[model samples]
Target chain A: MAYSNKVLDHYQHPRNVGSLDKDAADVGTGIVGAPECGDVMKLQIKVDESGRIVDAKFKTYGCGSAIASSSLATEWLKGTTVDEAMAIRNTQIVEELSLPPVKIHCSVLAEDAIKAAIADYQSKQERLREAGAPES
Target chain B: MRHVLLRLIDPFETLGLPATMDLDAATLEARYLELSRTAHPDRNAEVESDAQVAMLARAAAINDAFRTLRDPWTRAQALCERLAPGVVAATAKLSPEFLAGAMELAEAVALAERDAAEALAERIRRALAAILADIRAALTHVDARSAARLLNEARYWQKAGADLRQKLRA
Candidate 1:
């Protein structure tokens, strides 16, 4: 498949391509893969105390579309509230990247990764709250 | 009492064997030879052109079936597909811990030294062997999900192994 220059650019120079400490109180990490294609993607986010995303990072073992989708997700994730980030859909990513029908699944994987990271972060917060709760 | 369409699409059916992963290489080769002899275009030279074409197609399908059935991994994939129709068996829905481990291996593979690459490839091969053993058991029980997930993990290692080879070649 001939990728657009835009997809190629994101793939070649992916944004925020790294990891955040998943054990940290403020970091949420999401790992996902497509079994059919054997591609994996990891997306992590650092949320400030205000519950706003301060930073996002991703590392993907996938094709150009998968890499580009996660890279673009990280770029859009920064500074968005958790709710706003959750609202970000695969369609938007598809529109922004102009992904073909076949590669649309890549965008969905990216979106799922974002949600998983947020969920992980939220669960961590929940666990901490429960741990520190006063005894009944 | 299997469906006719399933029989048509089944690689084992093409090779005149039961749809089991435990088929021996000798048996497969013998069946393949037998089928090839019957379908060889040269033997059909006296037949009409259309019949010859049909034989050619059958021969091609047999070759395709054998090629896929010959590999343990490819055979596992085919078995998984048969067990779970339309299931996207190799996608990212893997467990979190496994994905993390795969990412770490992928990173290590990308920058390993020659000795390290060889060591890592060996390790991956071992891992694939273990996973394949589990997959074979899963296939026996018709546990499609477990088989699919294990096959996907093996696919990751196989790909990493291939990537390492390409890098070493470079």
Candidate 2:
């Protein structure tokens, strides 16, 4: 299928295409795979003390549409609150990318990656908070 | 002919074979050839035009069934889907560690020298063999969930292996 201009642009020049310190207390990493097409996507977000995503990155091994979807996701994640990031939907990505019906799953994979990353970040914070809490 | 053309038939049903993972290749081939000969549209040239259309559709469907069943991987996939409808849509939840490792393997393949890529490709092949065995066992037991999961994993390894081989060829 022919990719839209936006999809092609993100694919050719993907933004935030790398990794953060996954072990860091503030960084949340999410790795997801699409079973239909055997596509794998890893999306990570680093939240600051105020819970705003300060940075995002990703590495995807799949088709151009998958890469573009993740790349667009990371771009959206940065500067958004974790809750805001969670609200990001696959439909928005589809609209922005003009992905065909067949490639809609690629956008869904990206949405799952975003939620997974946010969930990881929240769980890490929960653990850190518990560790510093006063004894009952 | 009209009814046959209208309904969707699974590969096993189309080939008039038992829906089992342990299909005999020789038997499958024999069945496919026999079905193809009967389904060939040219043999229906003397029939009405609509009958010819049905014949053409049947011939195409037979070809598709053969293609889907000939490969062990796809055959297993078809069986799993037939046994557990909507299982394919569930998207098997692979572990995060496995996904991470797969990404790293893809990266390694991209950067590896010819010899290293070959080694990695061989490793993937071995892993695929084990997964295929597991899939066969799962299907034998009618464990659609396990079969679906294994098939999903197999697709990743298959793609990786193909990529590595292409790189080596380059």
Candidate 3:
């Protein structure tokens, strides 16, 4: 299928392609795959004490659209609150990427990755909080 | 045998095969060839163009069925979707650890020296073999979930192997 200029541009020059420290207390990591196509995507975010996302990165082993999708996700993620990041939708990503119907799933994968990473970050905070709770 | 199977046949049902990861290669090949010959449009009388077109579509579907069932990896991937259609979400949701391992491997592959590439290939091959064995055992014991897990793990190794090959070639 012929990709739109936006899609081709993102595919050609993806942004924030890499990963973050998944084990860090403030780092949230998300990994999602597309069942329709066997594509893997990893998205990571680093949040500060105020819950504002400070950095984001991604690594994808997938098609151009898949790579572009996650790359775009990272770009949107930086500087957003975790809640704001959670609200990012696949349709918005699709609009940003000009993804074709077939590649809508790529955007969905990116959305899923964002939510997963946020969830991971929240859970880690919960664990830290639990560990630090004063003894009864 | 061919005419009877022409009616609304799913790929697995067309091959008269179970929707499982483990398939006998010999049986798949034999059935594919048998059906190919049976479904050939030329085998139908040349009287009507309509019949020929219908036969052609059927033949194409049969070839597609064969393609879907032929590869072990794809067979499992397809079977997962088939057995649990609503469970598309269950497939390919890799873990953070798995992703980390994959990223590291990808980085290694990017800068792999000759010996390093070969070593990584060997490791991926071994991992593939182990996963296949687990899949076999899982299927034998009717452990579908474990079988899916094994197949999911195998996907990583398969990609790693492919990436390594491409890198080495470059």
Choose the strongest candidate by TM-score.
Answer: 2
Ranked by lDDT, top first: 2, 1, 3
- Evaluate every candidate with DockQ and list the scores: 0.60, 0.76, 0.42
Backbone collision tally, model 3: 0
Worst 10 residues of 1 chain A by lDDT: A127-136
Top-down DockQ ranking: 2, 1, 3
Candidate 1: regions farther than 4 A off:
A132-136, B1-8, B45-57, B86-92
lDDT tens digits, residue span A1-136, model 1:
9998889999889999988887888899999877656678999999987879999999998899999999999999999999999899999999999999999999999998998999999888888888995321
Worst 10 residues of 2 chain A by lDDT: A127-136
How far is B39's C-alpha from truth in model 1 (Å)? Answer: 2.9
Which ranges of candidate 3 are over 4 A from the true structure?
Answer: A1-14, A17-19, A35-38, A133-136, B1-9, B17-28, B47-54, B75-89
Q: Is candidate 2 or candidate 3 better by lDDT?
A: 2
* Fraction of native contacts, model 3: 0.31
Candidate 2 docking classification: medium
lDDT, candidate 2, A10-64, per-residue tens:
9899999998999988899999997656789999999988889999999999999
User: Model 2, B18-44: lDDT tens per residue?
Assistant: 998778999999998999999887777
lDDT of 3 by residue, B1-170 (tens): 32123223457876778777667888898999998897898788664998788889878887978887886665654555455442323545666677667666666766789977778788888878887777667666766566676676676667767777977787
